[model samples]
Each structure stands twice: as structure tokens, then as C-alpha cells.
Target: MSDQVQRDQTLDISQSFIVQAPAGSGKTELLTQRYLKLLSVSDEPENIMAMTFTNKAVDEMTQRVLSALKSSFKPKPKEPHKQITYELASQVMQRSDEKEWQLLQNPKRLKISTIDGLYSLINNRYPLPSQLVPRQIMAENWARDNAYRYATEQVLLMIDDKQQGRAIADLLLH
Candidate 1:
């Protein structure tokens, strides 16, 4: 198939997918298209999930999707690629503009987020099997530093004041 044809097929939200691409390579554009496609068929926007590696990416995707939805109401040139995206959005608008507008209002329900955002969502909704006490997650670097400090302390406790062990413990302390 032609690349355009493949892109259209990929954007068809009927299928599940994982798309990996380099930075500045239109991944966000494709993701926005897919999101608009989902909105085309589904009444509940909350059911759809769009995840990215960073919060910045999640925000970008959410904004782009919202922009597309808004554009769907306005008139645009009938360019092939844009027509495809706008067409899906138009269908959603035709079904019930009020419902679509309501869905767009609650972004938290929309489920567009980074991996850490998804983790927080899952933890909020479900109990852990381990039954551990719930706590706010520490920042990654801070947690890593604390882990290193604890490990160093444990190693120091294991070492006696013997010359080699004391030297190793001292090195770890510094």
C-alpha cells in the first residue's frame, strides 16, 4: 500500500497499535488524528486512553486533540489529510455537539497522560495486592539518592575498623 494509505489505516481507531518514532517526526500529529478518530465513533471520551513518556507530550497531545475538535466545527479546505481528520470530528459533532462539548470539558476523565500519570490513575482506582500503605511517590532522583545512602550505610555497618574495610567504608562515606 501507499504510505498515505497506510497512514489512513493506522489512524483508523478501530485497531489497536503502538507507534514508535523519533522526535519531531509527526508522532504527535498521528496521535491527535487517532484520538479524533476515537471521538468519531465513541460517545464517552473517558474510555479512550492516550499515553506518552513525558508530561509535556501528554499536554501537547491533549491540546492538539482539543484544537482538532474545535476546528471540526469551523470550515476548512478539503485537503485529503486534513479532510480525513476533520471528517471524523465532524461526525462526532453531528451526533451530539452538547455531549461532545461536555466530554471535552473534563480533561481528567479523558485519560490523556504520561506514564506516571497513568500510574497515579491506576493506583487511585485500585488497591494493591500487596496491601502496602499508600503514600505519595517520591521524585525519581530523590528516591534513587536515598536508596544509595541506605545501601552505603548498611555496607558501612558490615565493615569493621580493619585497615582495608575502614578504608572502603571511609570511601563510601565521602
Candidate 2:
């Protein structure tokens, strides 16, 4: 596998880059390294925008960036690359442009997010077709509540407990 991403490859400065990483992989490390690299060459400090899919990722990335920045931005130092791994995930995530940062500082931009949140953003950005039925309504909380109530009602309606147990098992498996 390639140890480093090749920068000479094609890039579109105006567009966002999406990197898909498998679970448990070193995605945070790679992202922070790329962010640091982006900062290294940029004349405009606020030009580069990196985002994580969830709040947890944002926290992780922010700490990694700050640690890397602190070490690199300083004068002669001790173990120089201690900040590389983000072992100490202790840093405040702030925007280079204060106004923009302030605008998006909620739990939304703070990083930890549900899949539904991401899908909503995608839908808003690239809307579905004109006549196509609108995307299935996301029962953010209703699905759980409704299914529980319906199942309980069905159990109460059944005469024999043994038959109800089999039906419940079948419903769950299917």
C-alpha cells in the first residue's frame, strides 16, 4: 500500500475532496497530516476547509491539527513530532475566519453526527427529481416508539401466549 498520498496527482482547488476510509483505519492521522500539509503551502490561512462526518471526528481532527501546529510553529523543541499522533486530544476547534466559525459552531459542525444528519445535507445540496416521490420520511424517533407499541398491542390481542411468542420471533427475524 502507498504510505503517502501523491500530491502531484490531479486536484480541483475549488471542490471538496472526499476520502472513504474503512472503520478502525487511521483516517484521523491521515486527515490531520493532509490538513497540516495544506496549511504549509497556503498563502491564505483560511482557504483550506477540512471536515469530519461526525462530532467525534471533528474533535479528533482538531486536536491533531493543533498539536501538529503547536509543535511545527514553535522554535527549537524537544521530541519534535510528539504532536503527530494526537495522543493528547486536547485542543479547541476554531475557525480561521472567526465569523464563519461562530456561525457553524453548533453540535452540527462540532463533528459528532448521526447518519440521518449527513443524508439530509446531501439531499439539500443535490435535490432529488421534480416528480419523484419525496425521500422516505425519516422517523427520527417514531420508528422505535411505534414499532414497540404495535408489537405490544399485537401480543396483548393474541389469545394464547405460545402462539404469540412464535409470531414475535418470526416478526423479529423477518
Candidate 3:
């Protein structure tokens, strides 16, 4: 890609763009740079949201941003990509210091999360009538157990039907 494209993606934060690329195309790096730039310009760290599809991606992105910020305190790295990250992180550190964001000390202020997490955050802030009760993400084991319970309930209900009950009995015997 041309430098202009790179600049547009990372430096031009005025407009949002959907980045679609193959694997290992430095999308995360570009996103981390853009996030740092956004942090420098944003009034509050929470105002800038970076969402990904999965929790793992969210964790990775958050770690990358935080790592970049921590790395800015060290000597400049030799790699070109690391140099870009260092420069952006340095700019963010300066802006953070001026604004008293305390990003390095309180990295949780950065709002990098999964899409589901964003929905949950929004729901927590402005819950719908149907969602009067707060919801929590179900753990894998809980989900599996709940699914089994639901399936058992459905099968028990089916047992009340004569034809289904006969089929179930035959299947069990077979």
C-alpha cells in the first residue's frame, strides 16, 4: 500500500473506515496506531471505543495499545513498525500528560472491547424495558448445562405426546 493510504488509515481520524484485509496484513498495528491517535485527540479515554469480534481480539488489541504506551517510556525501537508505534505512543503520552488522562497508570480507561461487550455496556447504561434485569455473559460450562437442561425439558414435554412418546420409547429400547 502507498504511504497516502497508510496515512489516511492511521492519521486521518476525522472519518471512520472499515478495514478489510487478509490475515497478517498489519491490521492490528494500524488499528493500534489509529487508537493512539484517537486517544491523543479525544477528550476522554472512554469516549473512544475500539471493538472487535471476539474477546481474544479485544484482549489482544487492548494489550497492544497498553504495551505501546508502556514502550514509549523506553528507548526507540529499531524496527520501522515499532518506530511508528513508538512515535504514536509518545504523542499519546504527551497528550495524556497534558490532559491528565492517567492512561498509563489506569489503562482500563481505554474502551477496547468485543461487540457483545459494547452491547452490554450500552444496555447497562440505557436498559430496555424488556431488559429490566441485568444480564451476565454465561460461562461455557453454564451454557452447556443450561442447554442440556433445556433439551431435557423439551424431551420431557414431548413425552406427553402419545406418538412422540412411543417413538422415544422405541428409540430408547433400540
Candidate 4:
């Protein structure tokens, strides 16, 4: 089925869903539409959380949803599918345009982001284990830095040993 039909059919359902498709298959558009659907129904975008694999996807989905919401206030597009989605969004936002506008203005409540983004938000909001420190998000390369540090320590250990250290160090360097 086309994305439009699928979107229309699933617009009212509040159940969890997954959109699996190859690249350029409108997966992002489907996600944006579904998010819009949620906005239409609840007017509580903060209550809707969406997780994607990459930062780019998160940004794209966020932008698309915002664009759709903004355009919903303007004249409907000539494209039929666009018209339907935009009108649906218009209807949903009608009662709480100010709140929705505020949501658009501030994205913290939108909750559309990468898995890493979600994790960071949760970690910041909650206390970590006694042994663990709060971590930087993926954008800061925290994991990579830790891995590099561990590897360097291991290499240094091997270099200091006299027995198999040379062989092991040579193997690792090569």
C-alpha cells in the first residue's frame, strides 16, 4: 500500500508500530506522518517518543514533523496526500494552537531523537549506578575515547613485559 493509505489507516491507533523499509522508501515521511497523527489526536507531542538509528534521521524526522505542523496552518497543498495530512494536523491543532506552537518553538518536549539521544536524556534525568559516572552523549565520542584509552593501556602493559610482550606488541602494531 502507498504511504498515504497506510498512514490514514493507522492514524487513530495508539499502539506501538515499526516502519521497516529500504532507503528512499519514504520511511521518514511515514514516521513524520505518524507523529503528526499523534499530535492530531492528543495535542501532546511530549507524550510521543520516537527513536531512530542515527542523529541525521532524528534531525530529519524532527524537521519534517515541524514543517508539516507549520504548513498545516497555511493553505493546503495541491497534492492530495499533503492536503489530507495537513488538514488532519490542522484539525488536531485547532484547539491548542498556542501549546503546539510553543512545542514547535521548544523541541525538548517533542521527544523525537536517536536512541543515543533518548539514552542521554534518561541518564541525565535519573541517577546512575553508584559505580558509574554520568556519560557524555555519542556526539562527544565518549565511548571511542574510552576504548582508545583502554587499548593504549594494554599496549603499554605489553611493551613493559619482557617475555611475549615483543611478539604481542608487534602483532598489535601490524
Candidate 5:
């Protein structure tokens, strides 16, 4: 499927390309095959990223690409003994033409992290803009810890309403 696509007129790197495949028309196979082909020739494979909707899909896609690449990734005449390196990854991650890869590799992004990480970045970028204190403080985890301690101290001072106090404590603790 991908071999045909590759063979089909030159896939213009300068222009965007989209293949609209209907339901159950080997879309996954074609996409993955094309992904591997692009990855092989790509100066920055990290740049040519593909996203699947689910973790299962991500796992499947990653495994398929790894396996396919492993099968085809052999020494060639133009590049003898050429192997994909971590340095090449770092280089591609550092710079790329793919927007998806750029977003995935951006140092500024907080991957699967709490909102606190985002707030911290925002605060560091612009304290006033992010509605945070201008001074440098501890990380989000540390601040959350300190807030919990302060809340506990407040609770210990005096609190008759058990439910209200617990709610207050929870808020401060988080």
C-alpha cells in the first residue's frame, strides 16, 4: 500500500498531503506503511509523527513502525552502516518540519502532567499574566506541600464544623 503511494507521483515535502480513506479500507495499514516510508527517508523522523486516538492505537502504531523499520533498516550503498542514533533523535526533536512532532517534543509542554506544571510555566513566563507571585518559589509539588501544611495548622487552631473544616483542608492540601 505504502510502496504504491511512494511510487505514485512524488510526495511533495513542500506541500501538505491528505489521503481520505473510507471506513475499513485499509486506512490503518496505509497510514502506518506510509508513516514508515516517510520515517525512513525523513532527515527528521521524529518530525514525521502520527497520532492515534487511544493508548491501544498508540501502542499498535509504535510497535508496527518499530517492527517495520527494524525489518527494512539495513545498510545501504549511499549510507553504509548507518543506524538511527539517539543523537539523531535529539537533533530531530530539537528541530523539525512536522507540527505534531514539534508539539510532542517541545520542552515547554507539560506532557500528561498536572495543571500546576502549566501554571508554573506560565508564572515563570509572566507572573502577572498568569496571576501568580512574581518571585521564584518552589515547584508545584512543593507549593502544594506547603499549602497543606499551612491548612493543617489552620485546622488545628480551632474548627467546630467538621464538614466545613474537611473541605477547607482538602482545598488547601491540593
Candidate 6:
């Protein structure tokens, strides 16, 4: 795709897009720009989520977005990519100022995290239905195995309860 078209698509927040490109191909830049655009138009900072595979990417993207917002307060950038970032950041900063978001003061409002982090956030916010314990996702296989074993033990213990046993049986039968 043409660069302009790709840029346009990235700025379009009305729909979602899966951006796939080789490393060092500005995918992060595009995503950061999109995130800034979303922030500019959104009232709730927590509603805007950007998920990546690794915590490293999450940190990088979060830093990039924050840096862009900070940089926007300075003079305009010379580089084309940075110029775009500055503009988007300026818009977001304007909206944030109007809404009194205080993003710079509280950057944690930005919902940029790894997929596992997002899952954990959801699990913590809305707990699982019954005696089923919510499992914390881990990157290491050993941790995952341990969590699974622990959850299984909890479920087994719950099986002794008549009501819980019936719920488990119903779930297993389905």
C-alpha cells in the first residue's frame, strides 16, 4: 500500500486494523500515532486499549506515546515521522487539557499493556462465576503448569460441595 494510504488507515479509529510489518518498519510508530488519535477523541482514557505480545513492546509503546505528548509541547519536529507524531500528540494534549485528564501527571491512565496483562486486568475486574479460581497468566511454562495445578486442586476441593459439584458436572457434560 502507498504510504499515505497506510497513514490514513492508521489514523482511522472508526475501525480496527491488524498492522503487520517487518521489524524496524515503523509499525510501532503507526500504532503510537493511532493511539494518540484515539486519545484525542476519547473522553475516558481507560477505554483506549493497545495490546501487544510482549511487556517490552508495551513499555516501549507507552513510553513512545508519553514522549510524543511531551514533545508536542516543544517546537515542531523536523522529521516527517516526528512531525506526524507531534501533530497527533498536540491534538491529544488539547483534548486532554479540555477534559482535565491530567495524562502527563498520571500516565497510568493509558491502557497500554501486553495481552496477558489485559487478560489479568479483566479477570481482576470481573471475577469468574463460581468456585472457579481466576488464573494468572505467566510467560514461563513452569509458572503456567503450577497455576494449572493449583486451579485444578481448587476445583477438586469444590467438587465435594453438592452445589459446586452439580455446577462442575453441568459444565463438564456440556
Q: Largest TM-score belongs to which candidate?
A: 6
In candidate 2, clashing pairs total 4
Q: Give the winner by TM-score: 3 or 4.
A: 3
TM-score of each: 0.65, 0.36, 0.69, 0.63, 0.37, 0.73
As a TM-score, model 3 comes out at 0.69
* lDDT tens digits by residue: candidate 5, 25-57: 655555555554454356544445565556666
Instruction: Report the C-alpha lDDT of model 1 over 1-174, residue by residue, as the tens digit.
Output: 665666777776668877766887667777778887776666677777888889888888878777776787789747876776677767756644656556445556567888888888888766586734444443565688999999888777768857558777678789
Question: CA lDDT of 70 in candidate 5?
Answer: 39
lDDT per model vs. reference: 0.72, 0.49, 0.85, 0.72, 0.49, 0.89
Residue-by-residue lDDT tens digits, candidate 6, 1-174: 797798788788888888888999899999999999999889889989999999899999999999999998899988988899999999999998999999999999999999899898987877678624444332365687989999988987887698799897777788
Model 6: residues with Cα > 4 Å off, grouped in runs:
131-174
Model 4 C-alpha lDDT per residue in residues 53-133, reported as the tens digit of each score: 898888888887778767877987998767766876676567347554466566666788888888887878665676254
- List RMSD in Å for every model shown: 13.1, 14.1, 12.8, 13.1, 12.8, 12.4
- Which candidate achieves the best lDDT against the true structure? 6
lDDT of 1 at 54: 90
Show where candidate 1 strays beyond 4 Å: 95-101, 129-174
Deviation of model 5 at 145, angstroms: 10
TM-score for predicted model 4 compared with the true structure = 0.63
lDDT of 2 at 172: 60
Model 3, residue 143: distance off in Å is 30
lDDT minimum window of 10 residues, candidate 1? 131-140
What value does the lDDT take at residue 163 in candidate 1?
57
Winner on lDDT between 2 and 3 is: 3
The collision pairs in model 4 are none
